[model samples]
Target: MNREKLPVLLDNEIIEIRPDQSLLTERYTDFGINFINNLEKDQPFFFYLAHSMPHVPIFASENFKGKSKANVYGDVIEEIDFNVGRLVKTLKEKGVFNNTLIIYTSDNGPWLNFGSHAGSSGELRGGKFDVFEGGYRVPCVILGLM
Candidate 1:
């Protein structure tokens, strides 16, 4: 039997920030907007905004709540879209829109069983934990730098 020593687990107080419970999207949007607004044209900067949304237990801010016809997932998506639009506007206002590179992508397939809370993988098969194409065949949208 091949016995491997397991790494010692550190005692850490993990703070749970539930994607659907906290203002995660709003906070990330603020961070990106602030960074873009304060960036200097004389120096190059790399801003990466990662948002956790449209996921399970998804929670949209009060402004976006019940604003969509789809449901929580749709509302969350709309919130993200609004934030992205704001980011683009900021970039354009800063005159760095043409130089910035924005890449939007997802980590994996959706949990179809999550119903309204889950995103669609379209015609792709398998999702989330499955080993199918849908599991890893996520969407990627690249803009700005051509």
Candidate 2:
């Protein structure tokens, strides 16, 4: 869930309440890895991983907390980076690395109003809720496509 204080639902069922927010990234990564491991070699599958991190009320697992120079926000981002690496490793181990298409991007710009807790839009104007470029522009990366 976006808010750690709320319950997490799976298929309309409550899976966890007040779960350790720090492990959110790890748990999501685990779910992706597990899905990949259970798939047949020729079976086509699509996995959508959405992470609720670096958002308001940020959190980082003990392994990554205070490990970044950019404070909690950076810690959360580092955790995400580490988890993405884990997923890539799993894909390679499952022999689907070259055939899989991976698309990574953000839904919107950072919440600049949050000050140090938010991300930088660089030279772009405005942020998350604004009508300027930073509000709508986001970064996208695609892999495994010729």
Tens-digit per-residue lDDT, 1-146, candidate 2? 36545887788998989988888889989988999999987799999999989878788999998999988888899999999999999999998898999999998898998876888899999999988999989999999966
Which pairs clash (backbone N, Cα, C closer than 3 Å) in model 1?
20-57, 20-59
What is the per-residue lDDT of model 1 for residues 9-74, given as tens digits with 9 covering 90 to 100?
214542432233447787778878998888766579987776768767688999898888888888
* Model 2 global lDDT (CA atoms, 0 to 1): 0.89
Whole-structure CA lDDT of model 1:
0.79
Query: Ten residues in a row with the worst lDDT in model 2?
Result: 1-10
Candidate 2: the clashing residue pairs are none
- Look at candidate 2 and tell me the lDDT of residue 49: 91
Scored by lDDT, the top model is: 2
